[model samples]
Target: MVNKNAGDIQSLTRMNQLYEKLLNEVDVGIHVINEKGKTIIYNKKMMEIEAMASEDVLDKNLLDVFMFRESQNSTLVKALKTGKTTKNIKQTYFNNKGKEITTINHSFPIKEEGRITGAIEIAKDVTQLERVMKENMLNKQNGKITFDTIIGRSQLMETVVDEAKRATRTSSSVLVVGETGTGKELFAQSIHNGSNRSRAPFISQNCAAIPDGLMESLLFGTKKGAFTGAVDRPGLFEQADGGTLLLDEINSLEPSLQAKLLRVIQDKSIRRVGDTKDKEVDVRIIATINEDPLDAVANNRLRKDLYYRLSVVTLFIPPLRERKEDILLLTQAFIDKYSTLFNMDVKGISEGVKTLLQQHNWPGNVRELEHTIEGTMNLIMGEDVITIQNLPGRFRSRYQAEEEPLVQGDEGDLSESNQTLHEKMTKVEKMYIQRVLKNNGHNITRAAKILGISRQSLQYRLKKFGL
Candidate 1:
């Protein structure tokens, strides 16, 4: 009888261990509370997410210990009262640092021998996903904004945001450098909006747009007879006084104009056409260049002195290919915008369409993606899915060929026919084991506990799998 009882105890212990391993392997965070609302069992992720230390969470009130305000009116409490599973409960809680965090919580009543015990709650952090949702909300509210309206979110963009934020606190000349369609104007607008000069006028001028002969008159105020086009007109520099002046493609200006621009940036003064005297102006200069200013200087296309004056704080934006993550984000944003404009119920791109979108390199970056989405919507009909078939011929050709070749075996049998089937499933099993290890941040002891296996057993498997 003693030997029989020992065998039964060992069997039960192994079963319980397996149950724990399954729970911790899940991506979501889970916790259990007793009838007294005290946390009895919780996964490592649940504790770590709440910034708790050790296994001290056990036997403590889940709410008081975690210091979570939502626990007071928690849906988990409601689940415990009614003994019903709460399907979806959304709540936001602030961390110790006061940063708001949003999570989706699902709770189920725990039962013991057909009697209610306490409750189990699962929470998933939807912060990034929630941001996408909110961005969609904002997009619909303001349809006028396009990819051109917002700055990028790449590391380059993050640096630009940080610099713009810092620049807002001070008055400095900021130079934005990038290829055409790189959203230099968008950065300028963001900087202006973030600055104390937001209320002030934000005037912009394209130095390359104006004729070389009328450049002086267009930049500085002119007397009545200053030039053929001038009739007592105040130039852009004076018009942008006490505000920001965005000089688009500043490198395209003539070398003489570059010298004049340098003088204005240095002295905060400008000279009108046919007028020798200078007038004081307090405009903050922000310039954009599509080419390297150094190359322009070396080629004698731009003045060296002016390049230094305008480039006090230089920002370089990488092309779209370098930041592929932003491609789909910008694409979706544009699609949402154009959908409303065209008055179509076209919801979104199909999975195949999305795959094709990612596979091809976006040469034109955000601008090309925007135009492609718009063009696709216009040419395609109905509320049907936007498939790769609907894409432009040029874009479609990029993914026309098969992605991967099928494998074949000897005797004309398909390679899959000779597969080991269950044996070959080892790859997936090993992958899952490694994922669990990673989820536990490679803490072997904790991973073993969560996996419901002895630490020694887990170590043995790790060596067998060479993980």
Candidate 2:
């Protein structure tokens, strides 16, 4: 008595749902377009990569959303037209909102019975990674970074910096722990620059950047016959001999590699892949993790013994939200840095923009703040002030529209915000000193030592700021 096609329809619906799940669940962005250049399938990651919604992309023309009518930059279009596959191609494009996004894509043409039907492209978002690489390159080019290169003045930051400065005097393996974008590498570089190995080669690698198979040789060099196309080369450990080797995101390393790393730290030597003999190398290892080292060990992401070996000198960089005093300071600093770089007459941000920046929890920390300013300046046009209108959608979406921009005279929001930053710093200092005093039970010398200041200076500040 059932409909004849009921079973087929049910099967089809379930298949579509499974297909949808496959597209969305993958880590990489996926996009599929028909022969006519119309976007037929766009997955969740693609939406994140392009910063567009399903309504804006689904069933829309590719050229209309991403490029000019005849632009050749779209990989989706290229595969469709050529009926060929393009692998590991880096493409740079602006989204519908005009924000620059860079992705590494592998595009394949969908063919049915030897006829090209459509094309699918898988993409990995490399926009932030590219930006970070550029910044690291700049730091290396500019005589490397020191503690002086860091840009935080909050009490927590000051404490961390003081500890890091002390750590620079040691030859022990250091673990720099922090959330993503909190500048752990910066601290590593600073420690190296401040140490006696300042002139020696300082090499760094993000453990999460490469595949597990390649990571072993990357750290401990490979012999000529190590594997296919392997050459006799010095790895990061050998390259960083008598200097520093910074392993960023060390928790991402495989368990076997972690054991190897621990052995290397203990033995002060490394054995190249496919080589039986080990040679001594004097390399100061500085490892970074984007979480609490204890949590990393507890979660089995990091080995406990390896954690102890690396944590001989642990430096924890506070996230941006914990040190809110640095927000406006960083905002104005980035505004100035980018203004010069972009050759724009941009001066400052508006009060409403400041409210949004302070209100929003900066999950990505300082790097996110810098990129926010950079992205804002990219589209600021000829405007001197960065009003709320200049912010990206993620920030703007939560901002109230009715709020008016408040600028004091011709001074841009940034220059005016300097005073605001100073005021906020003073408030934070007052609050911190009070808490320290309370915690130390109002012992002036103990609180002063804890604050990294003289008791006299603490008394002067306490009275001067009426704390």
Candidate 3:
């Protein structure tokens, strides 16, 4: 009888150990609380998810330990009180340390002989999962263009491209300076693709797109309990490990955040929002600015220190107006692209249309040219060549305005003796302003730049002449 009892005891002990091991090995967090809300069991996975140890929670009241607001409404409490199961319900709350936690929970009442005993809650950490999905989407949308598709042959553009190619040979940070729509992100991606880390991820984020409050955590990561609803998750720096991170519109970042960015660049390490330890990351940063970076620093929009670190290899992408020689080349490339995309018979732009295109300054650069071509291709049908009629309304109006004669009668008839000095001067000024405006695509900023006047001054003159 004694031997049989010993064998049975040993078997039960082994069974208990197996049960404990299985519970801890599972991915989901498991917690069991008695009918009185006292914690009865908490698995190892649960401890890790909560950023706590098992000893801290065992045999304690759930309400006392977590202090979850409105414990009566909690899934575990509700399941125990109502004797009903809550399956796959999503919950978000702040833990004791004020960190945000999100989880999909399944809570069930533990019963014996149809009597309520306790409640068991199973939670799956979804904060990390959601972050991973967001990063994956960004990766899918980046690195679609390469150097070969850049499509510019002007000396200014050639220099920019050459400098960009040279930048890819090293791991130093690159700063691309250009106006909006000048393909800064494209250059950044090309550099990444041409680098040794081409096989790794290429992540791009517009600094202006994210709110200032969330910028720090988004770029440097957040530790569990960093703030209300904060969860342990990797930031862009960590996500771009062994890869490239493109920060578009770096000047838009708040100055305080810029200082933090400088530290990250200098140290090659980032500490999560609530973390005490620094994590080393091997990421190549490529920052872009739409405005002159030095001007931005002078205006207090960007930190000077951050600028120096990021501009290790600055590549200045010339505005389309500055690279006028490449206008036809870019236009042809865009025409071919849109024609193939729309499955249209459009062969090319007419000489008249080409002349009109060359006359107008492209404020939006290559992107604007591509959009114009795409718009024209969508409207063309049964036509081999794009003409003035196929152009956008703005272009058509500008062309018509240019085509109109300056004076109603012959120039010889409207001699200097026919008008006063002021009248003749006013007429000439109006004509000159109109010509300048047309040349600059009616963009006040570019027109002002070419006219050697302030944009506000140009606006005043434009209003005066109604040009």
Candidate 4:
């Protein structure tokens, strides 16, 4: 029995030696502190990360060795005090030599027989990662808008925004389908900004803007001497590694390029236009199509396989004509915007101008409306309110052309309209409300805004009308 006990002790000593050797050889920094806050074990990687020698850190109090602000909030100290564990905490601190170090730390308490004896921390340095992200070209684009900047109160717009916010929580490929000028890129930017990869690059490429001959090299990179004047250059896929790539108007790509894109997405690697080797990339793809994606697929403009791969998450933005409830809200926002830009004191739109705006169809969507307001604001000399007379000539002509025929028909139909004034007005109101609701895809919140009524009031009317 004594000989068996002696053999167990020998085995324990050998196990401890192996554990110590394994800890020292790991790439991540490892640190251990006793319950008394004394450094018990500090691996070689930890020494290199802190730029300190073994003698300086060994057997020293953790607070005394670091002597920095982050020491007070150290995960190791916190774990020791609370007998709890903390994982994946990003920390930054200045070491003893006053050099800044940033790391992601995972710390846990060391328990012995239902009591906390010490704590161990494993840290991964991320300073170099930050440096590499900042060097990417996509990070250089200025005035990038986040989800916060997107403004819309209409129910249709709210639904789109909600779906977009949900998409940000994943690494799945996103496909945004909308008409031209429906703010597809804006939605793409919002998703990118809200994602975990926000700190990395957000490179955008309009597939239609680049010709087919050069598109391959521009997207997948090229080797030196691949073609005349072609030097070795990383493409958008390589540049956007660890980030997001916005492929605008993806349907414009030829079917062959679409096949290549699918392979890259499936294989997680790409071969340069003329290179024999394949390069791996970690990039999230956010594709935008200016038309209906299903229609594009049916028409063979987009590859079916590629469409399915990119459409793992899809967001559809309704056009301005379809969501007319947002027109006044957007108009007010634009007025504020151009007011600041053109240095105007315009505060509101006249009732007549508002009626005219509601009657006209905004075929070009939000982008067109913004430009219209900007142009009008530039022409306003000192008006505080924009009246119908102040509107552009083209807009006034279009409004007159549509209104004249409507007025003429109404005059001719008065003999047939024998109902009381109150009855006729109520009938017109109900008809208009129904039309607005249909236009907004039966979204009550949006229809309410178009009808200038509260949601509760709209609901009451909807019930009263049996709609």
Task: Report every candidate's CA lDDT.
Answer: 0.73, 0.84, 0.81, 0.82
Worst 10 residues of 3 by lDDT: 410-419
lDDT of 4: 0.82
Give TM-scores for every candidate, taking all chains together and pairing residue i with residue i: 0.54, 0.58, 0.56, 0.57
TM-score of 1: 0.54
CA deviation > 4 Å runs, candidate 4: 1-142, 402-467
**How large is the C-alpha RMSD of every model relative to the true structure?**
26.1, 16.4, 22.3, 22.0
After superposing candidate 3 on the true structure, give the runs of residues whose Cα lies further than 4 Å from its correct spot. Answer: 1-144, 403-467
Q: Residue 393 deviation, candidate 4, in Å?
A: 1.3
Question: What's model 2's overall lDDT?
Answer: 0.84
Candidate 3 — what's its lDDT?
Answer: 0.81
Best by TM-score: 2
Candidate 1 all-Cα RMSD:
26.1
Candidate 4 on 1-467: residue-level lDDT in tens?
99999999999999999999999999999999988889989999998888888888888898887744634488888899898889999876756754556789999999999999999999998866644554443335336777767767787888888889999999899999877888999999889989999999999999999999999999999999898988899999999999999999999999999999999999999999779998899999999998756668779999989988998987878777557888898899889766654434589899988887776656677898888888788667667799888888887777664443323353233322223564355456666788899999999998888888779668645643446
lDDT of 3 by residue, 282-401 (tens): 999999998757668779998878987988888878777667888899888777655544434466889998887886667687889888888887777557799989887865785575
Question: lDDT tens digits, residues 1-467, model 2?
Answer: 37758988999999999999999999999999997888999999999888899999889888898842233478878899998899998888877765667889999999999999889999999988877776666556556788888888998888889999998888899988778999998899999999999999999999999999989998999999878898998889999999999999999999999999999999999999989999999999999998756658779999999998998887778778778888998999899878655545577888988887887667778999999999998878667899988998776875554544556543223322224454456456777898899999999999999998878668755643445
Regions of model 1 farther than 4 Å from truth: 1-153, 402-467
Give the Å shift of residue 70 in candidate 1.
35
lDDT score of residue 336 within candidate 2: 80
